[model samples]
Target: MTDFASEMRTLIEAIDTHNYNYYTLDRPVVSDAEYDKLYDRLVELEQTTGTTLPNSPTLRVGGELLKGFEPHRHLSRLWSLDKTRDKDGLNAWLTRVLKLVGDYNKNNPEQPLPHPTFVVELKFDGLTLNLTYDQGRLVQASTRGNGAVGEGILEQVKTIRSVPLEIPYKDGIIEVQGEGLMFLSVLDQYNQTAAEPLKNARNAAAGALRNLNPKTTAQRKLNAFFYNIGYSDNIRFDNHQEMVAFLKDNRFKVSPDTNYFDSIDDVMSQLEKIGSERLSYDFLIDGAVVKVADMRTREVLGYTDKFPRWAIAFKFEAEEVTTVLESVSWEVGRTGKITPVARVEPVDLAGVTVQNCTLNNIGDIERKNLKHALGSLVYIRRSNDVIPEILGKATEESDGEEIVCPTQCPACGTELEQRGAHLFCPNRLGCRPQMIGRITHFASRDAMDIDTFSVMTAEQLYQECGVRDPADLYKLTYDDLINLDRFGEKKANKLLAAFDKSKECDLSSFLFALGIPNTGKTTTRVLADHFGSLEKVMHASIEELISLHDVGGIVADSIYTFFRDPLMQDSIARMQAAGVQPRAEEKPAAAADESHPFFGKTIVLTGTLSAMSRDEAADRLEALGAKVTGSVSKKTDIVIAGESAGSKLAKAQSLGIRVIDDEQELLELLGLQQS
Candidate 1:
């Protein structure tokens, strides 16, 4: 065991160094062949030893797709900055800062201070990412989800070429925070071959980082610019300039246009310069951050409940352009909701050319009081780094008629029905868009776990083979697939194998894969657990479904209505005939041992655990007959508290309920072993 450990440590160190050189420095010390050889050896040793370190480089080669993102407690809280757009607001903020500093200096005469220096930086229009490194090796990366907690995206972040996989500073643990963005050039290149082009760079970057597959992010050429240190152990910075310098010294990318200003006027001048030149950069910037550079001054100012008082974001007004609305087209979704898409004359938004934007629905149009006549001018705003949205009417037209809502489904010509504020096409069986969307959802990675299916394949199957539903996917033969465009024998066989593999999925997945209206994964699990069989669920009444804890009246009615459709019943029959029957687990209450500690007990889990993800832990606890609730309440029998546990743990303590700190202890209490 010691020998294996020694070998593993050496391999990890070598691999990490190579990764740092290749990913961070953009220079390869070793050839790809040599690196892969070392990586393969490390993987083999890890498998044999059955022990892997948290910072193992092999984890970057992400395997199975995740069910969903798990919440992670951050080492340091990430706070949002208060924002202002106009000169009046900026001046007011600056005045307040000056007054506060003067007061602080007067109160503390022993610590006389000079005029505060401010660091001005263009705020990159991208998703916030927090990266933590231990002993100079990157360990974890997460999103700024709710300031206190975030979703872990270490695997995806590792694929970003610009982020250093390893750093020179090995003094304890430190956190580097930055924005992850995709450049406009990269976006344009991606759109040329992308199936569905990204709407904007910011959303594209966010979506790529959150994607379950790291390879997808690597392919997108995502980049990052480190700006601040969220946490450090033994490292200190006197000012924000030093922090940026430290980041640059460690081979991490820093913003190229950061400037230090002593006065608000100089800061405002820099902001103007940045705003004017920001459009010329490869990436997007929506605003400039003006921060008190001196760390002492920042500490004196401190923070409010939501934002930092030491800093403020100077936002640029969203670029608005007026263009002629040529036409309004209705697009149908998988759920039968029809969305109004406006086709406008081409106009420049920021730098990208904009010709189309979402008008949302008939209600949105009415709320905006927009004229629906041809050649009428309409205003669109590309705000908050999102796809340009129709803002309001641009012209006080003298003779333009109101845009009339479509009476029929655009795809199947079926008459539309009004549901709440949206219009729906009820032709579930005949509508092409709905059928295609359902097929796509059913074959989605989270549903049946069919990774090889694509929208193009679904379209081909529908048009050529007369396939209308997901169950028909199983009926596809190798010959049939081979006959389709671009499907060779090898591809056909692989697709066939994926279908066969999906049949072995669990009951919850099968239920979710059915594309029932208003039924998400959680609701699907409730139905699967309550019924224990697909047949039972299909026959159960609304009263039975509504009785389940997670299912409400609307969801119950939707489930009841779905099963009552004869067409859906026929599809299920076809699916079963095609060999797609998923095995259901025995009811937890019935199968669980009565002597288990968690038996018939409500449990609440809070914070981060080192042993496994919260989702996995919850599943295990539930298997031991524990009911895992989200919040702490009087009914909570036990609270499994991990590191950095917050309000839920406090609530449990106040209620005098039992709490377990070690995950192993909790597992032992439930008579289970490590997963």
Candidate 2:
């Protein structure tokens, strides 16, 4: 008989070593396949021998429902901040800090500035939470609700794998303050479904942490970066970087975007640099947290009843300055979908001047029920900085009655229908805006990416050069382009070269460029792969289209509608006429490989899964050939689980869920035979 208990012990020790390697040290010695085998073996022994260990990862991988959130009185009170939103305000804040540091005499408002040191860090856009761990096990997680009475999530907090159920600290009890965040890509993948994706990372973290099911929270991949010491009885760190390094060594993920500054001026420069690098980070970063270096000096400087006087967060304003709306313009998309845009007075944001903000579709305008008219004050926000959105109406008096969606296309005067909140021009053919938008989409880089032609140039070619469609772009001569504004001979030649180069971008970009309604880049990739060529897609029936992954009802409707549109058909005809053919989709890239070890199998992960969450199983499986199917069908190859699996367990039993407990079974199913 295999001494199952001893095997389980060895497996736990090995898996824990790997966890330390990957999550703590940011280095992994073993492949996920190798790790999976060890994990599965441990589970197998534990189940067969009925032996479970303390702080077992299986129990700790996912958090459970909290009894309820309770208020935790701070060791030191958490304080609300006095914020500075712009350059002038930052200068003022610096001026005040210098005064507190005795840069000025009591009577002097303006004096020579004193040399002071500062720290700058990216202000992560996440929900603020205070975590308390007792003897390595997380005891309480509290929200920074109003800087005081935070909702406690005892059970839910346990689900986050990153939040260790136990730590190796000897302080007995350690309280840390940090931010909980989710990745934008995760949110976007979720948004693909009919259900709305989370609006932002902070909200996602807060909501997920508050969920009753530890499994759902586990699936979210919520991670945290410890930044501040809220309370600790015997902890000691010399400086901020020391704290960071120590936390990482002790299993907490630390922010990697931080830098050391020798002086306050250097810190400010770093702050400016953070503004530029903010958009590039994988996690949310709203601004930088600046702190003084020396622990003794920091103690001497002390803190307010709230924040440390030695540290301050320089927050980048996500909201653009108020701009006056000069007009509301309705523009038609290539699909003949009309959207309202607010043309506003230019106001500086971050570093650029803002003018126009999307009102989304007409439905958004009515849902928010914006009441502003020409000359009304409107606030613009680009919280994530891709698209600027109208915050709300700022004026009491209406300049004119609220503008309503037009019943006809302004460009072609075609009859329109109200589909949801959008007013669509049923006459998709020959509508001026629709045709131009189509041309723009076709030329856009995500599509065929004809680099040479721009929307404005396309317009000029349309009205002045008799180029009414995409095929006409290839017919343009340098002499004709040179005749246009900003188009010198050199510029014209470059544009033509780019347009010619677009031929090689592949079928996915080509289909996306077609700009069919609701058919985004991912959908195009799926369609191109399934059909093998653009020609096949053009001939495929709606039923076949619906069978493809991500071809929801709206996309199916759009596919059918686009093919039926004489204008859309004409455009496709012209593209074929001009030799813009979509190539067959290459093999679907495996998210992982044989070292990944489980590519094509269907794994129905249910309940609280130990070792990793259900989501991690699906993610890892997808990387292999393991399709992480949502529901267990008769086809489900494995059902891996943790404690208290409900309906899924019953259904899996009825449908033969191939239930596997512990990690080793899963590893064997994936064919990982560990030593």
Candidate 3:
């Protein structure tokens, strides 16, 4: 085993040095991968050691137990810089800088403006934090709280290994300012389990920074790029570039999207270059920042009320691409909500390959005004940081009226019922598309342990091989799948093996896999634990479903709604008839398991988890006979906070519930240790 102490120190040194170079001096000597390896190694060691230094990398992620936040004063009066939200404002700011540099030349007559007169850099969209390093050690970090008065998060800041527990620069007083952003790779993992995934990187960053547990925060893989020295003097630079270069030399993370420009036009060129390059980078940035190059000109130009008089952030317009919309297809889910996917001539948007984009509901399709026949150029846009969304018609001239909802199910030729804008296939057990959606959703990692039954394969099974529902999925044979397109011998066997494994998943997973309307993971868990068997919930009355704590009137209504249909009930009978057993272990009629850490205690799960998958952890927690609930209420005994854990963490604090991490509390409870 590697010595946790030694590796932790080394990563702190390397990452700190790298940050010093990138953020402080505007120069970097290492690749992002190398930096990540060092950081991950340090995190691993810390997890194993569990011996925390006040300045240890783990401590910076924020403690789960919010001690209490009181309004605090700022050391200096913080003020907002004057901001320019568009290119014109940038042009105006550049004009001011040029005039100032020209005036300085006229005043001194001897000093000349630098040939390369401006620094253009990408402006990141993230939280700004202030780090105070005293005698080579990070003393505290605070949010640019109100830019003046900020909350003290000294303990939390210690978790960012790159934040540098100790800087090599001794006896130097420097406060570094940087924007904190969560990486994209981390965000995708979060979206899979998130009930409401973040819309963009800024949202992810906001969630991560506010996380109560530093351990949970660490999992997000947040990075920072220092843009300025909030306070540091005596060390001088000939130009802004030199100052950026100096910060890089001092071991701070810096933005790579920086360019030198001798004129406004040249700055514009760099800004355009950044526009093209922005999608390739991991962090979310709205636009490029332009600043006067002359060191003295920056001082002379000074501040506007909300932004720098000498600096401006010129934002790029949201990226739009024209593509031929080849087809408008309806994706009918198990719940009968139809989402129109605009299949287009394969076009690239931002960084992702985009051949399809959502048209939301039937109304959304009408608003876009795509007539039944397909080929039309449509405007598609996604903020460099957002999911690709269709931006209406690229063809401005169109007498296009909305396509009528199909009278029959496109897949099964059954009648469609119009409740609202949505056309539902009330033929629940008979709809092929609905069956495909339900089976795929059931086998998904969140619902059950079906390892490799992909949506594509599920569709193939339904359409080609005569499989309709999840119960039908259990009847699939290896040869049946192998006969389909692209299903070679090996993958078919692998998929079949996965299906076999899924059959054995605990009854709770089976119930969740059923994809019953309004039956989410929590409700399924409660029902399973209460009834101890799928047979009971199948026979449950509306009153019995309502008796569960998490199930209120709406949920009760949904359960009764699912059971009211003879076909739906017959389908459950069929699943049972097919030998698929769904049953939960009923909690014994007893007070609480004191040994069951969360028994009789109210608990709330917030954010995301690493190590044990969030669903698996929650399942295991309930298995231990604990009451796992959503949202932190006053009755909550503990809060299991995860990565990007949001408002629940705050509410838990307001209610004074003890909070624990997924890795620490949940994993340990489940007998899995995070390393």
Candidate 4:
């Protein structure tokens, strides 16, 4: 007997340690070959002994794919926390808690109660997952689908290397509750290869874990952090801090930023700190969770019909301000879509002088219960510090007239067409705004790389030289440029030279410059990669387009319809005649050595680089056969993070992705030593 059981135990422990290092720490001590050797040995021992650990790394290989998830009832119901956006709400709740405690003390005067303390943690904006472990061995995992009955996803749960399959505690059953989350970087990575791109991180996490294919879930790299103990047979704690300590001891990833507040003011201050630092977090946080620290106080407070009385979620308010609605204007986009923009009284918002905000559409106005009256106090919200929007009217009474949508196009005076909730101008040939928008887009940095071009210049050219579209810019002569105001001989020569230089732009940028509806930078790149030429992309059929990954029916139909337009085809032809032929899409570079760290990997660069400019680093990475991307995602294999790197750096750390220090390290990783 070769002590098969003992050997298996040792193997499992070694593999688990490696998994922790690689997956959680992003620091691998052993080579892949060595790790594989250990895994193979474990498999051999397990087969010889006819005993296998539930959390063994070999089980991650998984069995047959599940058809559908079966509904599994949770041992105890999971309740949602009551939410509030105001500090006063917390005060009121705390007052109620004190009243209950005061009554408890009154009944038992001899047993005087001390002051209550609160524990605060970040409330992650993600799906809730309940995990069950029997005798300290991982057994089942389910979603908080209705709080009572949830879909079982044990197979997918096992794919998350962070979740412990087996722990040291071997006494009783414990059900742990955690937030199932996907980092923004991971979601971006998944979208790079997935046929259907996910809308956001939260949705991606939910879809991945709910998927029947454990392989797909594993590839998504879903992560979880335990927050609460839903059901425990033998475990008992006097306070929440002790419970958190136990979870940390068991190697469960809990919130490292949890704080104990002695007073309500202190809790509110902590909430403020949490809200202020929200952008620095790797995962999405909608708010902060405030809970009574004492477990005895929680028991005394008990549960409401839906939420526990002892806990509350303090949601952060949207960055908003009240501004008087001066008027509304409609602007025509390149796609001929007419958008209603709100011209408001100049108010400072997010440190910017705000004037105009999007009204979206008639449906949006209706949904927001807006009267659209001029001079109405409108509530403008800047959510996530992005674009500001007219959330709704602050008051019902207005001093000015009701807003009227334009029946005719704002730019060309053509009759507008209504499609669902959107308004569009069909006069693509004559609309000035449409022409301006399209020409500006075509000359943008991501498009033709016409760095000196501007919308003002585009407008001037269209008005003075009869340059109606992008193709007309290529047709401009020295005389035409010299005739325009502020057009010096030097500027004119530079403009002409830039226009000529744009002909060599890659097929991807050329397609994006076309401004096709439902097409973005990523889609344009994928389309260019698939077709390899402009002609193929323009002539691609709807069915052919839809067959490609990430190209759904809507996008396919839009691209197909755009290419079929006789005007568009004629414009493309005109450009082709003017020596504006774009280069064919380049194939991914082949690496000389497969062992190169950056080879065949997608890398992102962020912040100010001391060794070189961001673009220079990107160029070097691409030269080494690595895909240099603008954003960080789960699909990103490496991030060359530099000084003062913000959210992307935080996200890379959160997902446990490798972050290179400088340009030299990046070059070294690519196996390109400094010459």
Q: What digit string (tens of lDDT, one per residue) describes model 4 on residues 136-223?
A: 8889998875466677889988888878888777889999999778877787787899898775666567777877888888887877
Task: Please count the clashing residue pairs in each candidate, in the order shown.
Answer: 0, 25, 43, 6
Return the TM-score for candidate 3, rounded to 2 decimals.
0.50
Q: Top model by TM-score, which number?
A: 1
Better of 1 and 4 by TM-score: 1
Number of clashing pairs, model 2?
Answer: 25
Per-model TM values vs. the true structure: 0.59, 0.47, 0.50, 0.52
In candidate 4, which residue ranges exceed 4 Å CA deviation? 1-5, 21-37, 43-52, 319-404, 408-675
For residues 431-520, write the lDDT of model 2, one tens digit per residue: 888777877878875667676667896687777777767767867778878888777889989987887777565786777787777766
Judged by lDDT relative to the true structure, which candidate is superior, 1 or 4? 1
By lDDT, the best candidate is 1
Model 3 steric clash total: 43
Question: What C-alpha lDDT values do all the predictions have?
Answer: 0.80, 0.66, 0.67, 0.79
* 39: Cα error in model 1, Å: 30
TM-score for model 4?
A: 0.52
Where is model 2 more than 4 Å wrong at Cα? 1-9, 24-26, 49-54, 60-67, 74-76, 98-116, 192-196, 319-380, 383-675
lDDT of 3: 0.67
Candidate 3, residue 470: Cα displacement in angstroms equals: 2.7
lDDT of 3 at 268: 75
State which candidate, 1 or 3, has the greater lDDT. Answer: 1
